[model samples]
Target: MRLRHLLSASTVMLGVIVNTTAFAAAPDVVRIGVAQQGTGDPPVFGGSPAATAQLQHRVEDSLKTDGTKVEWIFFKGAGPAVNEALANKQIDFAYQGDLPSVLGRANGLKTHLLLASNVRAGVYLAVPPDSDIKGVKDLRGKRVGIFRGTNLQLVADNVLKEHGLSERDLRVINLDSAASQAALASKGVDAVFLDYNLFKLQRQGLAKIVYASRDGGLQFTRQAHLLVLEDFERAHPEIVQKVVTSVVQASQWSSDEANRDALFALWSKSGVPAQSWQAEYANQQLKDRSSPLIDPFLIARYQAVADDALRLNLIRQPVSVNGWFEPKYLDEALRTLKLQSYWPRFDASGKPIAC
Candidate 1:
């Protein structure tokens, strides 16, 4: 009888130990890597659903009860640099663009796509103030600056292709945003492909805006997403769910059309002017750009990006978009928050589909 009692106690203690071990699996710190830097000294970014989460402290608030610290590490080198940090295990989650993320996956980084953080960001073509280059065709034989290895590169190359030009036809210089802007200011490069940030150069009288992607249509834009290192997600899925939930909450808030002014106000902390954000999103519905759903449109776009990368020799091996996404967390969050139909779904061609 005493032996049986002792065994019962031992079993209870073993169960307690196992439960404690499970609880302890949650890390004390969660590091998230951001692909680009914010404008100011303290460094905050805006313009995406993930950015909205950061701005609103959604993730931090979600994890705080567990005594977990959330750290947002921004990389000025953009997605490529974020990929390096992911390889080093310095970060568990990342907000990165399509190409660099695909490149990382092709190179053997294990991560699962969690959510579509942002999409359909337009591209811009800017030239020196006095240059006569008026269109993409005129870029042939000219010194063009592009941030190579970024999502920008593939689209820029395609834009060139559409105009009967190629990277081979131009003196292509690999430059990041700041360097490209400086090169344009110094007239070191004849033209630079940029995003909405190009407006800053035009406002400063440093560059001329020749082409805006919005003028061409939706196909001209690029996409980005929130992802988690597979190891981390496998180890602490609860924490991953919390993070995804917070981002979805932020996306919901950001997608509300009534919060337009308030949303820009929050984003302007990144040192971009409120007017710039306003102009960037002008005549556009907030819900379309801020949706967190990994719908058919997003999947198709990523697959297309992967194909383009392989065909352009941008990635050595084919990065399959299939099984790359883990959407259960997102789906669960939408269900839990009752936001299943909050954001509209889009088809592969960017057209809205009924729920």
Candidate 2:
């Protein structure tokens, strides 16, 4: 009887050890996908280890304490590739522009918005530096380079409509941002509708900004959003909270004058010239407000985007913006991390004010 009791105790101890080990190893590393642009033009994600390191550090700091790890995957192609990876379950989260996210939602992919970035940042209509084109109206019969199913196209369409022009008014060539920059430099297209950052190359005298979407307070509403696979969020709430916390912290860090300089330095190493960085940095600071918080206005804007996307046939059907976003995750993360009180508050005019 004594021997049997000893044996039973040993078995119970072994079972406890096994259960602890399994519990500790249950959660897998989170995979994040980022778009990688080529070495030329605006330099989205190519060079600079310091910048990448900073980003990695921010992510680790957010998720590491809970035994979660993050693995980043870079895709060399455009938004379509990123969306494909998300669809294939290869990545848990990504930063995508407005149009691609809309397209992704339309294709039966489950996605949710984490936060909004740079909604008011403008798009530029550019031409070769020496070209005589003076305004949007001048490109009526010219070939225009644009990335279909991206924010650039949305801005182009809205701007053209404002000018009493339509898609039929110009020759539209579907091209990615880098390719569009090359096409513009080589004069393959008379003009290109591109993001504000891409204008960095044009500022180098490689091209010229013929028109900016911000000219008329037009509210072009070009935006980038943090997206998470719905299923991933369902399975890993803690990991998702960590990601939201980190992104909020990064945005706050980027807001500081000192850290802004560091970020610019990182961007500069990525092929963005100093002057261009200064200009784009200022513009981004204004648009992003560097708080990484969402507001009612942002939600309304997202709803508007979904409506416009459906009307343009960029999306098959309208997605209810309310169903796709849950600010609770962000709010909880901020509160838990002591970030809520420190974040900048923006007024109705989109200007930052003391909270």
TM-score of each: 0.94, 0.83
lDDT of 2 by residue, 1-355 (tens): 9999999999999999998775544265877776555343323452222133334477767666777777666665656788999999999987667777777877888988887644565678889888999988898989998787666677788888889887789999988877888898888999998864565767667898878787666357576667799988877766777777777666655656666666666556556565665765454443254445676556665666778778777777777666877788788867876877665555544556565
Candidate topping TM-score: 1
CA RMSD for every model? 2.4, 4.9
* Global lDDT of each candidate: 0.90, 0.70
What is the lDDT for 150 in model 1?
84
Best by lDDT: 1
lDDT of 1 by residue, 1-355 (tens): 9999999999999999998798667798999999997666657899898999998889999998889999899998999999999999999999989989999999999999999987888788999889999999999899999999888887888788778888999999999988998999999999999877777778889889999776776666789999999989988999999999999999999999899999989998987777778878988888889999999999999998898889888888877899999999999999999999888899998889986
Off by over 4 Å in 1: 1-24
